[model samples]
Target: MSSTQHTDTLKNVRTISTLLYWVCAIAIIFQILVVPLVWYAPGWVEASTSQMTVSLADLHALSGWQKYVTMAVMMIPSLVLAYGLYRLRKMFGAFAHNAIFQPEPIRHLKAFGIALLAQTLIKPLTGAATSVLATFHRPAGERVLSIGLSNAEASTLFLGGLIIVIAWVLGEAARIDDENRSFV
Candidate 1:
């Protein structure tokens, strides 16, 4: 192939690379801003005669701006992810109807892997954050966000690393396949 062809292919790959980074970054940022609020917001539980138990549902019943704001934040992760995935899939180059990658309907499958981490962390973060705010003045026992992250949060790093490795393998396979085709 001519130098121009090689340059064009490299340019296409570069665009895909930029897309991968942007999608993942947006997912992480959106999760960061939203999940903590949901996890930490107040809830309701029955109280004993001697002691009191706050119902977690009490937070759900909150009215006016509090309810609306919390709901909006909670939905941010899903909305941002859907939009980013749409863009990333477009950039990744879709599989044809009969392509080996099947489901020409999908894109950014690997990049959306970040959403899995978001699922595991956001709940706990929101719960801890809500508790901290509600009891801001109290003794602050066992601050979930402060003392240490949950086991799930810690595992997410490993999952993200694994996703990266899988992406590398896919890239290497594509490169090898391209090189072999050139000789044919």
Candidate 2:
């Protein structure tokens, strides 16, 4: 291909990639904010809908403004990070196809595995933390960190969080390998 054609192709790829990166980032951000709020909302608003008791005592305390701020803070970055990592994978894939060191994809894959394993560790820890929080809650509604949520609920949240992070890390690792392979 002509040099100009190659340059145009690269630019097109970059544009497409950047758009996808932002989309993923936005999703992650939405998850971050929405998950926690939604998680906590069960007992207050939606419990009847579920035909069960679901306490979101933890989130009940946040004022309207605080909720918005907290939601943005938590969700936006979560999305950015996840989306960035996912984008990395795609970018690397392209690099692998074009570059010399195709073997790098293996490295990325391994790193993804490691990330997944590492991410798995967080839920249990979060659970432990939640359990600890629960003990101190004493039905007092005092502490913000009170492990008020049932073990099952907390575990689910923890697990979901872990999965998100692990998925992101795995994506990043995979991309790394892609880039590596591209160099060869």
Candidate 3:
């Protein structure tokens, strides 16, 4: 690419990185307020007709700290997702600063990939656990143990693999660049 195109691409990356950084920051901050928000805003938190099989009212059925545990079970993956987005923001920032061949961006990519993989694996387990917890206060007939591998999870797993492969390819390229420098 020409200098102008590269500079424009860097500008675009920097803008996207900034947007993602703010989004991640806000998501992480919002996670801290979930319990209170659920307490005060039941209608907003609980959507009975939504695609979500279990509503906040279902989670509200849990007694004492068990409710918090259920919330944590749900929120933890979101935090992981936020952290992954933050890592991607950092990686994009590195690209914006012309640090493509450096270790830091590669490390960020690897971390983000691992985070995505972890989320993909944990989501089904957490969903089942959350369903069981939500049923804790429900009648026997209403209780359920559910698990499934959705398309979203599959796509995320694929994206995680793609990111890891990209990171490995970049690492190899960096090593080759170093070797070439040595030959000069």
TM-scores vs. true structure, each candidate: 0.45, 0.37, 0.80
Clashing pairs in 3: none
Using TM-score as the measure, which candidate wins? 3
Best by lDDT: 3
Task: Give the per-residue lDDT of model 2 (tens digit) for 1-184.
Answer: 9999988887776666557546645655654554465545554446432311213443344555645554444343334335434544654554535532333533443443443344334434443344334334345654333213345544544654565565566567667987888999
lDDT for 134 in candidate 3 is: 74
* Model 3: per-residue Cα lDDT at residue 148: 57
Clashes of 3: 0
Model 1 per-residue lDDT at 56: 43
| Each model's lDDT | 0.48, 0.47, 0.75
Worst 10 residues of 1 by lDDT: 45-54
- Residue-by-residue lDDT tens digits, candidate 3, 145-166: 7675678789999999999899
| Rank order (by lDDT, best first) | 3, 1, 2
- lDDT by residue for model 1 (88-128), tens: 45435443112323222222445545654454456444544
Candidate 2: segments with Cα more than 4 A from true spot: 1-27, 30-54, 58-105, 139-184
